[model samples]
Structures are given as C-alpha cells and as structure tokens.
Target chain A: MNKIILLNNRPTGKPQASDFKFTDENKPEIAKGEILLKTKFVSVDPYLRGRMSNAESYVEPFKLNKPISSGCIAEVVESKNESFKKGDFVSGSLDWKEYQVSNGKGLLTIDASIAPLSTYLGILGMTGLTAYLGLTEIGVPKKGETIVVSGAAGAVGSVVGQIGKILGCHVVGIAGTDEKVAMLKSKFGFDDAINYNTTKDIKKAIATACPNGIDVYFDNVGGDISDNVHANINRFGRIIVCGAISAYNETSVPTGPRVEHFLIRKSVLMQGFIIGNYVEKFPEGIKQLSKWLQEGKLTYTETIVEGFDTIPQAFMDLFEGKNTGKMIVKI
Target chain B: MNKIILLNNRPTGKPQASDFKFTDENKPEIAKGEILLKTKFVSVDPYLRGRMSNAESYVEPFKLNKPISSGCIAEVVESKNESFKKGDFVSGSLDWKEYQVSNGKGLLTIDASIAPLSTYLGILGMTGLTAYLGLTEIGVPKKGETIVVSGAAGAVGSVVGQIGKILGCHVVGIAGTDEKVAMLKSKFGFDDAINYNTTKDIKKAIATACPNGIDVYFDNVGGDISDNVHANINRFGRIIVCGAISAYNETSVPTGPRVEHFLIRKSVLMQGFIIGNYVEKFPEGIKQLSKWLQEGKLTYTETIVEGFDTIPQAFMDLFEGKNTGKMIVKI
Candidate 1:
C-alpha cells in the first residue's frame, strides 16, 4: 500500500496540517518506457504556500483532492526505461506519495557520491540557482558594496548571503530569532545579522547594520521589512524581489508604504523573477554550485522530519519560523 | 535694476503665489570670462516643487530669502568670454531674473533658426533629453508592445508618448482632463488615452484599453494612478520612474498599495532615474531629438505666461494641472 497526502482544503490566514489529508492506495506500477520511484526526500518550500491558493501566479494552484507535489529525491525500484536503471538516484517533480511512476522525461539522474542526495533538493538545486541568478543578474553585487538579505536564515536567503560574501560584498542579514541571527554570523559568515523579531525599529537597525547604505537587497520576506530596506537604498541600487512569504497567506492583497517616491529619489532598480526563467542555465548553475561545495566555500543546513505524515507539518513550520534552514521530509 | 523672485516661506500642502516674493536688486556686472545674459524665457517645471522642500534630493533646496533658479534661454548682451558672443542665444541654469551674469562654463549656445528659443526650454533641452533617455534606456518599449505614460499631457509625458508612437508601440496616455486626453490622441497620436480624473475605475479602464497588458509604464505622476498601472503590468514589463509630481507637495510620505508582490509574480523591472545620470549621453540625445524635429516626427507646445513676475504663479499651476504642456515665463 502507498501513502499519499492530498490538499483537502485551501488555507485562510495560516496554513494548518489538517488542510492536507493522508490516504493509502496501491503503489503505482511501471510500464514500458516508465520507471517506478520510491520517495527518498521531499522538499517543503515557502513558494508551495502560494500554490495552495486559487490566485493567478507563476505556477498553477494545487487542486483540492489531488496529490500535492514538490521537488523529490527518489530511488528507482523498478525500471522498464533504458535510461533509468533500478537502484539509481534521481530528482524530479514528484507526488507526495510512497511510490510514483514516471516516463523518465523530466527526471535527472543525480550522483549521490558528488554530494548527498538531499543536497540536490536544496543547495545544489533550485534554491541555489535562484540565489545565483537573482544576485548576479539582478542584484549585480559589486566588491566593497553592501548586500542585505531578508529571511536570511531560510533556504534561499542563506544561499544569497553566502554568494554575496563570495563576491566580496559586506553582507547583512535579517532573520526572526537570535539563534538564527547567531547562525547567520557564525555559520554563514554574514558581516552582521539583525533579529527582526527582537528589534523594535527595523529601519534604524538596518541603518546601523548597513552604514554605507544598501547597494543590493535580496527580498524573501516583504512587508514593513522591505519598506525599511527601501528607505536606505543607495543611488543606482538593485532590489531582487524573490518572494513575499510575509504576505503569502493573507486572504486579501497586502498593503504597505508605496515605494515609487523612494525608488525615484535614489534612481534604484527593482526586479522580480522566478527560477523557471533560467532553466537553460541550470547546468551552469549546478556546475558552479558543485564547485563551490567541493572548495568548502559553501555549506548548507537542513531540518529533516522523519516521516511522510510530517510533510504537512513541516511545510506549515516554515511560516512559524520553526525551521532553521531548508525543511525537508524523509520518507 | 535686476528683478528676481525669492522663496518667502515653504509650502505646507499645495503651493500658492504667496510663498514667493518679487524683489529688485542692483544690476550685476560681467567679469573676465563671463557674459551678461538678458533672460528671454524661464522654465517652470514640476521637479522644481521637489526643490522647494528642505529635504534630501537629487538637487539642493531653494534657500529662503534667495533668488530661485531655473533653466533659462537668454541672449548674450555683453561677452567677456571667448566662447560666447554678443547677441548669441544660449541656454543654462540661471537665476529667475530678467538680467543675469554667467561664466559660460555650463552654457550651451543655441541657434534659434533650427528650433524656437523656447523649444530649447522644452523639446530641445533638458525636458526633451529626459523624455528620450527615460523612454529608451529604462522603459525599453518594443514594437507592438503597449506603452503607457502618466501625466501624459505634460511636457515630459507628451514627448514620451510621441516617442512611443515613433517606436511602433501602441501608446496609451493618462491625463487629468478630457481636452488633454483628446490632445493626446489627435495631436500626439497616442493609440488610446485615459482621463484619470474622470474615470471611475482606472484599473478597469486600463485593462479594457490594454488587453495585452502594459509592457512599459512611463510614470510622472505617482500615487493612486501608479498603483493601478502596477496591477496590470505584463510579465517582464519595464516601469520608468521619471517624476512623482503627485507626492511632491505632501507634508509626509504618501501611502498606497504595495507593489512588491505584483512585481515578483510578473518578473517586472521598475527603475527610477534623473536626467543627470545620462549626462555623458546628452550629445546622442540632442542629435536624435534634432533629427526627429527636422523630420517633423516630434512637435511641442508651451503655455508661456507673460512677464517674469508670473513665474511663481506658473510654477504653482503645475500642481493644479492648469497647463497642458510645458509651462514657461516669457520675460
């Protein structure tokens, strides 16, 4: 029997584990030109929260009563496809099920020896590519310039700050807790990290942290935090709008101080992009990320929950600021 | 005697003529390498309002009890400089007075035969260059794409829409009156025009006009109108923030709907810039603007208020949307 999680209902303000229902069914079978995959590691991302709503977005909404899907690291249990042999590790967009059958079209056979299989679901995968492209293409961080990133303890923001440091920038991070702030400074080598939850005046805290003013801002959490960052951007600054995890669960569109005046005064540039736009550059991104990993210049951390039943809870924990870094479920 | 306008007091909300005081002083003498200029036309621009406030900005504030300065087209009455001659027409930053002295360091000699002297204050001078660079470098309007210009009947915006038409784009203009709206479509050749003052729902009107969505937004008026445009921007859209006339007079920063979420979902690029940023490219801008003028592809209009004493009133009229195009003072 196979266990799967289904989106039973849409979320209101904050998502709950009860929103998803677990059910058991027969394991999917493999046919000609297909391979049967046993789930190994499943990624729980902030962007998935956007898919739970019916609003128009970069990706389609997850339908009710349908199996929820995300990036999954799986092992081939049986194979009829010549390309994917049994016992091989691969990654692809797969269902939250114990077993899945794929035609091997979108699957990429990953080498676990190069790095852990879970790393392919994170630092060497979509999150890493998002950081690389957003920072280089949009943020365009220069040496000696200051780069500030919000949600600094999360999966994408952690990678973004590391890349900023690698590019010779003064990196400042904003996270929710002192523990996360300490990890950012000690583990990630961020020049300074602010605890947004403890700080009363975010604007003043950011001003103190970034004395030279911000040149590039990687925004993962948007709201008053972004408003404060905008107030201090230098001339010709670049803002990379990666996500708005702060407002993703709101039933209505969120409102904050308008940014046009600030943007015009400083002659700044702000851009928003999704990782799918750089699909053609994935191989290059993977190569560079892997090289950095091998050089010991980049390190990653993950919070793993040890069962498929915890998938819903792990995803909800992202909003609660309960996870230190990338949150994944080991099935 | 030299007559000049002085800023008596800062405005609280909307500027009135009482904020300025007309005074007379001794006539200045020209020194070596200097030329005595007889002011012919003085420009009253929306950006001048920003200079009236004692705030950090691209340009310095107008000091109280001192003569305000603006772009002036003048005739050289006496030339002690080798670069300028008697009776030569020139344009440069000068005090708001009938007679003034210059060193000719930042002055550009103009030929009135090529274009009117006041055209140097409008279409062939800083205003023209502003429209050109903001549209091309930032807006980046592509053929068949829809380009929307707010404050569409004003000096900078009129030129922006006309340039959009020349670039083979479906140009849409947003103005405050029906007459300006008609002028935009008939005289400026905009494909469509919206009267933001009369429209009940600007977002719906823009949606109906631009079924394909806005590809480029040339913003001059920033407030509620900009909020509506942001809601309808297409994927990969470019928003050029040239001026924020709507908020220049407010005592405090204005609030509106947040754009970070909208920007992130569509992968849009929004940038703010001053014309001074493109100073190195002025020669290119002038050459292109001149070519367009000679080709009869671009035309300009001005509301020339007679007498220098009306300069204060002319500047105030901008906020009230009293002038259709460039507002200037004929001295």
Candidate 2:
C-alpha cells in the first residue's frame, strides 16, 4: 500500500486543504520498459498553482481523482529495463505518493554519494536548471553589469542571483522580507538586496542599489517590481522572464506596469525562458553545473517539510512567501 | 530671410496649429566650421510628438520657444569648412525651418542624383534604417517564417513588411484602413493584410491570416492591436517595437491586454529600437539598404506634403495615421 494525494476538484483561487485528499493505493506493477520508484522528495513549485486550475497552459492540467505530478527525486526499487536497477536514485516526472512507475522517459539517474537526494529536487534538478538556463541563455549577462532579480529568496531567484555573482556581474535581489534580503546577501553573495515590502519607492531603491541602472533583470515576480525595473533599465538591457509568482494566484487580472515606451526608449530586450524547453541541451548544462558545484563556485539551499500529507501546505506556502529557498516535501 | 516654426508651448495632448507659430527670421550666418543649407525635405514622424512633451525620454525633449528638430535633407549654399561646397546635398539634424546654418559635424553629404532628395527622408534615410534594424537586428526573421507588421501602410511598418517578403518570409500587414490594407498587399507585396479597424476579433483575424501564428512581429501601433498580436505569438516569437503611434498622444495610461503572462508562456522576445543609437553601425546598415534599393530588391513610396508652411499639419497628420508611406514635407 502506498499513500497518495489525489486532486478532488479544480481550484478557483487559493487551493484549500480539501482540494487534495490523501489516500492509500495498491502500487506494485512494473510493466515492460517501466521502473518502480519510491519518492524521496516531492517538489512543490509555484507553477503547480497553474496546473491546479484548468486553464490553457504549457502542460495539461491535473485531472480529478488523480495524484499530482512534479519533478520528484526518487529511488528506483525495481526495474524491467536495462537503464535502471534496484537502489538507483532517479529524478523526473513522478506522483506525490510513496512509489510510482516511469517508462524510462523524463527520468534522470543521480549518484547518491555525490550529493544528498533532496539536493537533486532543488539545486541539481529543475529549479537550478531554471535559474542556470535563464541567466546564461536568456539573461546573457556581461561582466561588471548589474542584474536585478525579483523573488530573490525563492528557489530560482536565489540560484539566479548566485549565478549572476559567479559570472562577475553585480547582483541586486528583491525579496518580500528582511530575512530573505539578508539571506540573499549573506548566503547567496548578492551585491545588494532590497525588501520590497519595506521599500516605498521601488524604482529609487533599485536606482540606489544599481547606480548605473540595471543591465539584466531576471523577473521571477512580475507586477509592480517588474515595472520598477523596466523604468530603470539601461540602453540595450536584457530582461529575462522566468516566472510571475505575484500574478499566478490572482483570481482577476492585476494592473501591471505600462511599459511600451520604456522598451522603445531603452531598446531593451525582454525574453521569457523555461527550463524544460532546453531538454536536448540538458547534458551539457548539467555537466557545467556539476563542475561549478564541485569547484564551490555554486551552492544551493532547500526548505524541506516532512511527510507526504504536508504537500498541500508546502504548495500553499510558496504563494505566501513562507519558504526561504526551494520548497520541497521529503517523503 | 527664412521661415521657421517655433515651439510656442508644450502640448497637453494631440498637438494643434496653435502649439507652433510660424515666423520669419534672418538667415543664419555660416560660422568658422559651419555650413549654410536650404531645407529640401523634412521628416514628419511620430517620435516628434514625444519630443514636444516635457518628459524624461531617451532623446531630449524639445525646449519651449525653440523650433522642433528632425532629420532633414538640405542643399548646401555656403560652406566655411573644406569638406563641403556649394550645390552639395546634405542630410543632418536640422529643424522645421526653410534655411539654416549648422556645424558640419553631424551632417552627411548625399548625392541626390543617385536617388530623389525626398528618398533621403524616407526609404534611403532614417525610416529605412529604422525598418532594417528593427527587422534584422531586433525581429531576427528566419527564412520561410511568417512576419506580421502593424501600421503596415505607414513609413517604417511598410518597409519592415517589404523586407520580410524579400527575406522569403510570408508577411502579414495590419493597417488602419481597407485602402491601406489593399496597398500593403499590392504595393508592398505582403502575403496578407488586415485592416484592424474593420476586424471584429483581432486575435481570430490574425489567426486566420497567419495560420502558423506570428513568428516575428514588427509593432508600430502599440495598443489593443499589439495585445492581439501578442496573444497569438508563436513559441519563441520575436517582437520588435519600432514605434507606438497609437499611444503617442495618450495623456493617461492606455488600457489594453495584459502582457506579463505572454513573456512566460511563449518565451517571446520584445525589444524596442531607435535608429540614432546604432550610429556606430549606421553606415553598414545604409550600405545594405542602399544595395537592396539599387538591386531592385527593395521598393519605396513617399507621401509628400508640399510647402514648408504645411510642416505642422504634416506632423499632426501622422497622429491620425494619414500618410501612406514615409511622411515628408517638401520645402
């Protein structure tokens, strides 16, 4: 018997605890080219909110009475294919349950001795890749340039700021709280950090932090913060849109910044990027990221909640800006 | 004596005739390093409206009681510098004036025999450079791909659409009137043309015209039309923001479709471009544009408004989308 959390109904706004129901299910089947995996950590990202509501999106919405799926780090218990065997750790699209099956695709094998299993769910997995590709490919940072990041304490933003620092650019991070701001400077080595909740004039705050104006902006929380950054972007600046956590939960359309003139005057390049879209380039990216980790040039932190029953709370916490780093639920 | 229009006051909204006053003044003397020239053609563009307002922009706003300046083609009558002589055709940053004396630093000598003097104000000049840079550098069109251009019958937009067709891409043009739409297909050689004013559902109209969705969008009129194009932008689409004639006269923020989400889903690249900033590479751009014209790969049209006294109305007419191609005032 395996414990699984199944979607009861499509959520309208903020998902309630009743929206997901925890139940026991029989799971022991391994068909041809399939492997049975035990969940070590179930990742909860803000994008899951989009999946909770049935809307036109990049991926299909989760159906009712089915377990929610995400990038989970799991241990291969049994295998029917040559790719994996018993005791091999893998990470890919998996269910929020004790064990599930994957048919060799979208699954990644990880070495347990190299890093902790939960690290794969946060740093070495999708979250880190989101930051890596977004910064290097989309952000296209230059040496000595300033890169501003919103939602700086979150998984992707934190990694982005750290990577910006590693790439020799001045990194300014904007978060919701004082603690997150402190974490950005102290833990991530960002040049400057701003608590947006405390700042009255965000544009002034960004200008004060970045005297020369922003060169690259990795937008994770796009609302007024994006507008503030848009106002101060330098000529030929690059803006990378990774996510918009601020607007994802809204039941209605939020008033965003009127930015057309700013784009024209500055000739800024604003590009959006998703990590999954770069699957073919994953091996090269992962190899470089692994080397950066081994060289101590890169570091990551994950906030873990124990038990599968805490998945709903873990996901809910993402919207409230509760977690400091990548929010992961250890099963 | 020379006739010139001086900026009497800053415009509150769409500029009227009262905002400028025509006056006769003594012809400016040629200084030690200056040249005296007679204005031949003056460019009346949408960007001039932005220059009239006292706002912080990429270019310095026009001062009150000063004649508004724009790109103009002139004939040199007197020269104190050795580089220029009488009867030489020159293009430079002059004002809405009949005759002016200027330093030779910013002026470029031109051969009117190669192309018409008005062509220097339109296809062979700033409008051409704007379209070239906006499409090649910003839009980055791929061969066999589809490109959609807004304000398609206007100066920059028409050239951009024609360049798209020349690049072997199917070009869809969106203009204001049915006549303009017909002209876009017939004169500009566009694959399809849409009169956005007549189209009930712009998204559906664009979808019907471009079954593959717009891969490269050269946006000139930025409002609901831009929003409609953005909603249907293909994955990895590039949008080049050359001008926003629709929003130039707007006193308050324009209300339309929200775009922060589009940045996330499509990984779209929206950039603004100005020709002056690319001065370092302008010669190269001009050479290519000139070669295209000489080879008959490029065709150009001009909406010539005769008389120096008609400059104010020529400029005002741009706000109403009155011009078919490049709006030039023949002095």
- Model 2: chain B TM-score relative to the native chain B: 0.97
**Superposed Cα deviation of residue A94, candidate 2 (Å):** 1.3
Predicted structure 2: clash tally: 0
For residue A149, model 1's alpha carbon misses the true position, in angstroms, by 0.9
Q: By TM-score, how accurate is candidate 2?
A: 0.95
Error of 1 at B137 (Å): 0.5
Query: By DockQ, who's the top model here?
Result: 1
How do the residues A132-173 of candidate 1 rate in per-residue lDDT, one tens digit apiece? 988998998889999999999999899999999999999999
Tens digits of per-residue lDDT, candidate 2, A136-158, equal 88778998999999988898889
TM-score of each: 0.98, 0.95
lDDT of each: 0.91, 0.86
Most accurate candidate by TM-score: 1
Candidate 1 chain B — worst ten consecutive residues by lDDT sum?
A: B255-264
Best by lDDT: 1
Q: List the residue pairs that clash in candidate 1.
A: none
Residue-by-residue lDDT tens digits, candidate 2, B1-331: 8898999988877999999988989988877877889999888889989889887778999998888899999999998989999999999889888888888878889988888888888888889989998799878899989999999998888889889988899899999899999888888899999988889998899999998888999988888888888878888899888888888888865665457677777778888888878888788878988999999888887889899999999999988878889998888
